[model samples]
Target: MSEWLQLPFVQNALLGGLLAGILCGIMGTYVVANRIAYLAGGIAHAAYGGVGLALFFGLSPLLGVLGFTLAGALIMGWLYLRERHRADTAIGVLWAFGMAVGVLFTDLTPGYNVDLMSYLFGSILAISRGSLAAMAALIVAIGLFVICFYRDLAAVSYDDEFARARGIPVTALQLLLIVSVALSVVVLIRVVGLILVIALLTIAPYMAEKRCRSLASMMVMSSLLNCLFAVVGLGLSIRFNVTSGPAIICVASLAYFAFMGWLALRRRA
Candidate 1:
């Protein structure tokens, strides 16, 4: 492990994994609490449109994706709040558009040289300094927002009607949460990609929810669990020469099954 740590690519992979775990762990609590797990993948897939746009225009993919994701979040959030029935249709539309635009742009680009495998699966070891910096900043921002709005979010999460009656800006807060999911997807895509992001976001939170008594504790434990998966997955990938993202997801899945088995034993006892 020490020798591997000395390698620059390994170091970047570890750091990238850490950031992904932390960001997903925190925001994932909100996603699970609200029963909006499905929203994450949609927003993530839609961000591919941004990536495509950026690639087409020779701009930074991160910046382009961020802009596109924010737009998708707003549209989804508003649809969800105003007409829950209509949101799925819009999500479907955005999902298709995102993928279509990405493919179209990539095709049109002359000598379009990009790593689709890395985007689709993951490329943690290839993380650049700028990506790391952006991820850290976004994670910090998310942590602060979650901390500041703990009480309000608690109300909204557990009882939306009660929160609304208490004069909480449910619409605004919901939009903010959805946007945060977008930011999380951006960070997580490097570790797991849009295709597998929901697993990374939800698996830890689900396990954490089983033992935690409050939302706050769930976030903390989920973050820890995510960190565990990231580290273990990186180790497994290194040892076996496997893909990092899927390796992590497999670890998370194993842990989930283990937790479920323990619960069953306890119930039988």
Candidate 2:
């Protein structure tokens, strides 16, 4: 591991994994608490539009993805407030539309020979210093924001009506949660890609929640699980020459299912 850290790309990948793990843990807790996994996945796939636009404009793909997904998140959050029952319908529509538009834009862009695979499966080796810096900043900002409003968020996450009864501005907090979720999705796109991003966001937290009592404990356990999976997966990828993103996610899935199986056995016994 020490020798691995000596390589610049390895260092970048490690940093990227750390940031991605933090984002996943924090945002994922909100997702679980709010039952918004499908919604978050919709936002992630919708970010493909931003990626395609970035290719067309010769700009940073991450920025474009962030903007597009943030817009989609806001729209979904607003719709959920007015029509909770139809929110899933709205997400499905945007998810398909965004991906379709992205494909069209990528096809139309001249001399744009970008491989869609990296974006789909992630390429942490492609993580640059600038992107890493931006990711770090976003992670810090997200951490700070969550810390400042954790109580309100926890209340709203557990019971929106109760939060409202307590004058917690549940609506605004929900919006903020979704927005943060969208941003976290963007940050994770680099490490897990758009395709498996949802899994990375959900799996560790899901498993951690099983062993943890509070959201804070879940975050800590999730982060530790994420880091372990990331590092071990990256090492395995290096040895096997496989894709890191899917490798990490696969490990997470194994851990998640294994825990579930154990829980089931315990219940039966």
Among the numbered candidates, top TM-score falls to 2
Q: Please report the TM-score between candidate 1 and the true structure.
A: 0.93
Clashes of 2: 0
Return the TM-score for each candidate structure. 0.93, 0.94
lDDT of 2 by residue, 1-269 (tens): 57877999988887787777777877887787678888888888888888888888877887788889899889878887777787888889998998887888899899887677877888987788877877778788989988999989899998888999998999988998889888877876766687667876788888887778888998888878888888877888876888888888788888888989999999999
How big is the RMSD of model 2?
1.6
Model 1 scores worst on lDDT over the 10 consecutive residues at: 187-196
TM-score of 2: 0.94
Model 1: lDDT to the true structure: 0.83
List clashing residue pairs in candidate 1. none
229 in model 1: Cα distance from truth in Å?
0.2
Off by over 4 Å in 1: none
- Alpha carbon RMSD to native, model 1: 1.7
